[model samples]
Target: MSRDIDYGNLMHSAMRGLIKTVLQDVADHGLPGAHHFFITFDTSHPDAELADWLADRYPGEMTVVMQHWFDNLVVGEDGFSVTLNFGDAPEPLYIPYDAIKTFVDPSVEFGLRFESAEDEDEEEPSADPMPPAINTDHAQEDADTAQKSDAQVVSLDSFRK
Candidate 1:
């Protein structure tokens, strides 16, 4: 039987939710201990909003470190807003979560990499779904045996190759 669920998309959405949750926690209680975020997002995405000069500076992507310097951090359901220092000037940046490619807290060695929704090659869902090659039996075993961690390394190299 063909699988109806899109596990990859489901996992991606859940991970993004995790990002929102963490940001919300920080907004409420401030950064806990040494935890800081390295949020990388597509500056050119339509939903992303930044200063004109900033967009010119980072035409493709930019990673902002939210350690000791960011202010007015707000996480919304679909996006976030933050004020960060830009050469002694404070610049407000609004980034849609869909535009965010990665979120990392290197202090805790935690990170998540997301596939850019703007990838030109992505095709719309077909009327008929394709069947997965892997068997479902091992999925439960894998889930049961896997351990949880604050960090995970996802290599884009695998996808590239």
Candidate 2:
């Protein structure tokens, strides 16, 4: 039995599960009200599938907005596939859960950021273990005021050991 508790990996799993649930809901009953998603994923992931042009365009990562128009959203255990309009062309993409870098719903001031295992491995032992604060609010207001106001800033480091 391993005594080590992989809290970081655990958190990542939970966050991915949350995203899957939300996306499944959207797929079943359309995006409700003002809810929208800004999903940024690593395009280089082996399981991620996209057009050759898209891969050439976003060699590293890509962010897709799920608002006004989207089609064929199919959420699966490992990942999800969707068709999004790029300019006038509809492009289909498959993004694995592990490839996701960030998920944000600016409309409701909610967001999640995931650090890849490679990133974690590259961190120096002396570096701060705490992840940076995530500002859920995307309002175009003064940063100082926004920080001081009721804007929600979530930090999971508090839950870590």
Candidate 3:
């Protein structure tokens, strides 16, 4: 067995750790200033827990905004649970970190997008592992402007050996 450092997996783990830390801080002291998040996760993930109605509405993936009105945020080692208001009804959701697809904080123009393992497998094999794409776009932009241009995405290839 050849020993090799899996930088791609390492980077993914580090990014997830960063998300966990950020959420933990928010759960402790609440969101600060204009810092908010738009998190998109796979509702079909085995560990993802949500209301049946929500599952029916969003069969594949769902995006949740953590800005003005979210409560009972509890971040754990594996996942986080939060209660969000939807049409005057509060719904509690538990999302595992592994289920997360994209996490964006447009307030600071920062975002991270995770590709599924299957996506990586579909790509042609190469000596170097492909880095996940990081989008730095403003979600507050008008729909037309947003659609006109693609978000600038930065890759971690340059940082790799």
Candidate 4:
């Protein structure tokens, strides 16, 4: 009996399905009542497509709120695309499910955070399983040298004094 299943991956997939379901509902019936979404995703992810200006402004990760003025909201199995207004100009944004970091609906006080697969894949694994043994003597000497350096420590007690 192996209980060591990949629950995290399964949970991620389930959450993504929730996002797809919600987006599909929005496409079919529009955002119900006051429910709006705050979607945060990686702009640098290969699957994501943003306008040049948007990519320039948000080179890392960006969060977009979908509330008042947005159109052409299309929810696909793996991704979604929507035309949103920025400075009175409509710009299309394409976001893949894997790139998404967080999804929130503040009105309902609901939120979910996702681990980016791209980021995980990019992380370099350690060469050796066991870390190299630390040399305490060298480390202590280094600490002593740092203490003797020109670094200044300002204590909060000085302000009180």
Candidate 5:
């Protein structure tokens, strides 16, 4: 006996909830409360372009924060672009919707995640494993070193812990 799943339509249906929450705030109030997005993506995608200098500086994955200070903020049907302050340098970047990998907001208790183009091209590196927790976003910090304000990066195994 065999059974099949309509995974494409199933995933599309689930992602709708995440997209709704994130876009709703941006659409209605121009950004919700103190919550902002930290979207990480592939800078080399066909529809992607960042300052050549930044592309070289962060070759693999770079995370950008979407907050009020951004300029030329526009969400298009295909992609989005805005001027973001990288340290003291303000750089403009364009990212295709397809390039987006993960969207995390530490301000809220929720997270919106997606896969990267590279994910289909190769197998991901293996890592140490663990158990599960109440909130998968929770992470550990070095009491003497790591800053308190950093975004949480829970271990993938933390979901099972």
Candidate 6:
């Protein structure tokens, strides 16, 4: 019997692991280091729930600043929940493991992207049998990570000299 090595499953688990780490850090130590996330996700993802009000507002993807604007963020086993203030009202959103599309930080210029399993499975299979959606070779794909690493190395050179 042969089993499938679903790249979607692999990527999903890997992304979840990264998110779990960040959530755990915030839960235990209260946002340490220069890491805070600007998470933008598919609001309509099956596991995601937004009041009709907010859903209509953000039909595609919406970015939330986790640094100073969020309150009562809770991390759960399958998903995480956070409350954000829109105007005079506060809206609560729960994003499941599969809903997250991208987590970005403009400050540090680092990003973690999560692909939904459904989206992955929708891809047309090439002759290779296994298709990888996350590619780091492309310039646009790794711009943030490369840019930050370059900036850090440049700054570190001064201290070494």
Candidates in order have lDDT scores of 0.68, 0.74, 0.72, 0.68, 0.55, 0.59
TM-score winner between 3 and 6, please give it: 3
**Over the stretch 70-150, how does candidate 2's per-residue lDDT look in tens digits?**
899999999999998776688899999999887767667777767664655764642532222222233422442232233
Model 4, residue 92: distance off in Å is 0.3
User: Pairing residues by index, what is the TM-score of model 5?
Assistant: 0.63
Ranking 5 against 6 by lDDT, winner: 6
> Which candidate, 1 or 6, would have the higher lDDT against the true structure?
1
Residue 33, model 2: lDDT of 88
Candidate 6 Cα errors over 4 Å, as ranges: 116-161
Q: What is candidate 5's CA lDDT for residue 112? A: 45
lDDT of 6 by residue, 64-160 (tens): 5565456677888888887766654677889886677666554565566554444446657335211122222233335433433332211111222
Instruction: Give the residue spans of candidate 3 off by over 4 A.
Output: 121-161
Of candidates 5 and 4, the better by lDDT: 4
lDDT by residue for model 3 (47-139), tens: 999999989988888877776678999999999999877666788999999898777666666777676666556757534222222122334
Inter-residue clash pairs, candidate 6: none
Q: List model 4 lDDT by residue over 4-79, tens digit each.
A: 7666677778888989999999999998886766677889999999999889987887777677678999999789
Alpha-carbon lDDT of model 1? 0.68
lDDT value, candidate 6, whole model: 0.59
* True lDDT of residue 78, candidate 2: 100
List clash counts for every candidate, in order.
Answer: 0, 0, 0, 0, 4, 0
Measured with C-alpha atoms, the lDDT of residue 39 in candidate 2 is: 78
Look at candidate 3 and tell me the lDDT of residue 30: 95
Error of model 2, residue 84, in angstroms: 0.1
